[model samples]
Target: MLSLHANVYAHPEGAATGPRRELRGLPLPTLVGPGGGPPPFLQVLPVTFEQMQAALAELPRCDCEPDGFFLLTGHTPEGVFWRLNGHMQEYQPEDADGPSMHRIELNGECPVASLDAVLRTIGWPKAQLAFELVREGVTLIEADFREYASQPATEGEPRRPDRGASRVPAPCRGRDDAALGTSALEANASYTPWHITFGTYGTRLHGDRRPTVDLEHNEYGTPYLPRNELRRRRAEDTLTGPPVHLSAEQRRLIERLLPEICHRGGWRIHTAAAQSDHVHVICDVRSEVHGEKVRRLIKRWLSEALNEKWPDPNRLRWWAVQGSNKAIKDESYLQNAIAYVEKQRTASR
Candidate 1:
């Protein structure tokens, strides 16, 4: 008894890396447990936009009324699911004051028989009401489910139209609706990130010399060193490097302090690597966390740490004088940043 017809989206390498299977011909891979054990009781359907739309069309309409269905989109590793529970509402985009677009969830205790009829009509053929588990990420997606789905026990209680409350039990009688009790069903998935990364300002990352005030307002911003100081540093780095050179110890100190700032702010630091002109950091910050605040914390810590290690006449600013204030709302963007951080050397070159 698999969820979502089990065979809906079969991948050759498994759901995790499959090229995207279709029911047109390919067979769904058997979902095995750890150590090549027996097939797991639950099966996952990693659906694409088109596939999801097709499946949505096949879902049976509610016999209990207030027609509803669980809708999921985006990947679990991308933080898309966070928007569903309203935690990442800031990520939701707005254009010219238009109505906000969001998925809707409707819960009513409909008899399983009636629900099955809808599935049958839609050609599910073996669809069943199972526990719906959602996965988290940039966007939410339904990953798997239990054979026995429990719905809230509205028990034939007709909801008042004026009150906008309805819980009918005609769709799946005897089947418990208690499981759907939550405001919305979240997916059952998690991510194991290797590291976090952040971008720094400097000539290596961004080239050009301008006044500090003008640079701060520019998209790229001024280099980490002031024009007067950078001119001297650039001269040193000219033969020795492209920017001022920090000893391995200085670099190490700065790197170590990055994780400290992220941790103090209740964020996770994946990794930090310093280049001649810029440093790359991978970390997870909250939606409400200000980018400037994060930069300031890291800069303050790094400056203090470096000063303690070695007092220099030329004070160094850790970040470029520009603002990189923007949140990544999509998985692709987040992933790109991760890769860029890992290969900061190549990216800077």
Candidate 2:
């Protein structure tokens, strides 16, 4: 079933130029019809990464309680069914009437905690929930259940909330509380990725530099920075010891110590790299956490670490005065950022 009821978005020829159904060497999903023989040639365009991002951006928001219905992967243990004290129907997702996925339909007002308690009580894994969205229609979507984001209520129209995206059920018994697990329900529906790839001092002196993130912080495509403005930027900025250029050794050291620094600052590192004139870090932090604050903490920690290692009498600034910090809205955006950072490490070696 399509995770979101909306039709899958597809860009016919953009990322589908490869000989096989692959973009940048990653295989795309097979586009097949109900007849379902060989599952179509990979050369056919399936959901492109960009299209997937677009689809995610258009996901339904959970305005209120995600109560009416939900689905679970695998036949829920009978105990779980009884525990929910709600309607539970077990079925399999099919193609050509062929069962493809094990799932259970849940109905009625349910609490997320109730599901958690039951899962734990029945020895099921706890807290691995995320909204399952799939691209369907032109591109066959494969997921455990059918779901779609609901539109806002009109004068006489009804507002249908996203149902317990994963196992995050909410109260529908007696309350119309607007805050009832809304965030949790929208977790996978329309995710806000916080991944960013910012440049360090001297790394980006002008606009349109290669490998540079745009104002929106998109890391895909070639970097764009004007070669002409380098001199102008250097003159306008305060000299902080001739633009810190990390040596190979220094970069490696920073990579090694950054995790602990991030931990100290109450951020969890996901992927990180240090380069000659720039650094990249993707860390998990609270939604309220400020990017400037994260950047500041890293700058201080890095300066201290360098000072402790090299033992400079006069403390030196190790980063640029400005950098990119924007909320990542695409799901694939983080994946692309991780790949970009990882590739930087590979090429540097």
Candidate 3:
């Protein structure tokens, strides 16, 4: 049995009862597999960010491996919500006084059936319950299952007015068809261009010298080191030699090498520019190809070509570990990326 808790909210459309009762450590029967083996029991914990962090902190450090999975569900007014599916891998407290953060590795499949059971237990009618997976989180794989129990269905056959199921309209299939597009090319299109920018070792920028960005909560949630603090740290941590800046010959070499490398790697280089301290490239890659890998490959090829030409005995690091890898979602974005890379000097000035 899996014990779960929930803080129920009033349904926007109003429920048969005023509002569903809050579940408090409610024990749910474990599912049995076809082979009569005990299937994995998942606890659906609908929590706020603060609550989730608190729950994670309360967990005691144990040598025993995780036996169950947890589904973290949360909502925002701006049509943003998260349905994170993962088991606690490790827990470590920031300090003796602070709360602990659990490092969770995301699982590919979320137990929708289990979630349905949870909703059913909470008295939400099956007909009213609807969810769609949305890809918006920083962890490219992490997605939200946006629930729409209150909304009316937009597509498919009309429901009978007399039926109990009719009280709660069918799930609204919002822009699934339109967003995916109709044609085969549109469906499997890899038209998204990548805007890659990498700096030479030891250059300060908007987001450098900070704690690594949490891929799960990439934008707002992550803490970044202040620019002044970064500059101070850089000043304090001086190197034996000067910072690695690209020479005129090196920049020229990069310009000559990028197109050939892109062609060989089955990528289309729309625009590329090599600067004294950094490099930028706007390239079209396959739909499945990761932008990070593309940037790494560009840096690797450039570094190798440069190393062969000007073999430095000191073995200096050519490129910084961090770089920008933005995807151009549309034609306008692609054009903008191309222009940005092409006129890199003018933009910098």
Q: Evaluated with lDDT, which candidate comes out highest? A: 3
Off by over 4 Å in 2: 1-193, 197-203, 206-237, 346-348
RMSD of each: 23.0, 23.0, 18.7
Residue 39, model 3: Cα distance from true site in angstroms: 38
In terms of TM-score, which candidate is strongest?
Answer: 3
lDDT of 3 by residue, 24-113 (tens): 221212212223332211222233224433444333221111222333343334544323333332222234243222222332222344
The true-versus-predicted C-alpha distance at residue 88 of model 3, in Å, is 26
Under the 3 Å rule for N, CA and C atoms, how many clashes does model 3 have?
Answer: 0
TM-score of each: 0.32, 0.39, 0.40
177-279 in candidate 1: lDDT tens per residue? Answer: 2321222312432222223223333443323353332335422322344456555455445331123555566666676677666665555666667765556
- lDDT winner, 1 or 3: 3
lDDT of each: 0.35, 0.41, 0.44
